[model samples]
Target: MIRTILLLAASAVAAIFSGCRSAESTASIPAVRPFDAERYLGTWYEIARLPHSFERDMTKVTAVYTARKDGGIDVLNAGWRNGEYRTARGRARFRGDSTVGELEVSFFGPFYGQYRIIALAPDYSSAIVTSSTCDYLWILARESTLPLETFRQYKEQAAKLGFNVAALEYPNGRPE
Candidate 1:
């Protein structure tokens, strides 16, 4: 009887520990803030990003946005792969408050998903971007290269957002 009781107790303890870990992980995620859509509408070069499946092995990434005739923004994304240029086009619309930097970007047919600007510079020259669910993330720059100090600051911000900043892949053209 004692052995059975001890086993049950151990199981309970393990379960409790697992629950605590899960809660802690979830709580570590940073809160999303409102972003200004208009001020964010422009071309941005990808400076760094967490390793993602779609963008793996891609370099020289750039995203461009222009006002659309139907009150949406036309999105054009391009990158260099294997010495060739690859591109994709999409559309984005402000989610709720246009002043807040949040929008839904769609590339495959009509399906859309959240694109939130989590951090940005005062001149809008650089920004740290993420999706609503925190699955996608990217660091954007107005120029092709990012200064070391600025990159470090952005990495720190991304770490606070529950991202593994160590996983970021910086572009190869610039020296670290």
Candidate 2:
């Protein structure tokens, strides 16, 4: 009886570990060519994102990138949470190739991670962005709200990029 109980406990532990491994494996994001800094430098309102530690429970988020005098990029991120304004400043620099839409952004300090522009609209109205590890994603738009058709198209593109499109959370408190 003791041996049987131990074996069953071991089996349960293995199952739990296997489930965790599978979840981690599916969290990866797809790769895309580097992004064009010059064209991408502008204001982007966050339409949706995968729940992330840095941005959890946040709403009314917007990011603005500007060309810097030092040949780098300046990043200003702002959001409204709990009826107050929240902001963070950061910097970004191209890693492999800027034209390919891949760059690393740093907020606290030298720590940086990939910021890939996977899908972009021809009119520059919206884009689907992803992180290097595929752990984070953001749907950005020039306007506070995206048209239904445009939103659908972006969702399709994000699905093609291996993102969990259904996991996206639309901005709360957005005007209908």
Top TM-score hit: 1
lDDT of 1 by residue, 1-176 (tens): 00111222343355467863221232234324545556777888888865655666788788888988787898888887789887877778877766767677777555565566777888788888765433456788888888889988888878777777766776545425
TM-score of each: 0.77, 0.76
lDDT of 2 by residue, 76-146 (tens): 88886678787877777776655666666766544565566777776678888765433456778888888
Model 2 has an lDDT value of 0.65
TM-score of 1: 0.77
Whole-model lDDT values for every prediction = 0.66, 0.65
Residue 103's lDDT in candidate 2: 67
- Would you give me the overall lDDT of model 1? 0.66
Report the poorest 10 consecutive residues by lDDT, candidate 1: 1-10
Model 2 misplaced stretches (Cα beyond 4 Å): 1-35, 173-176
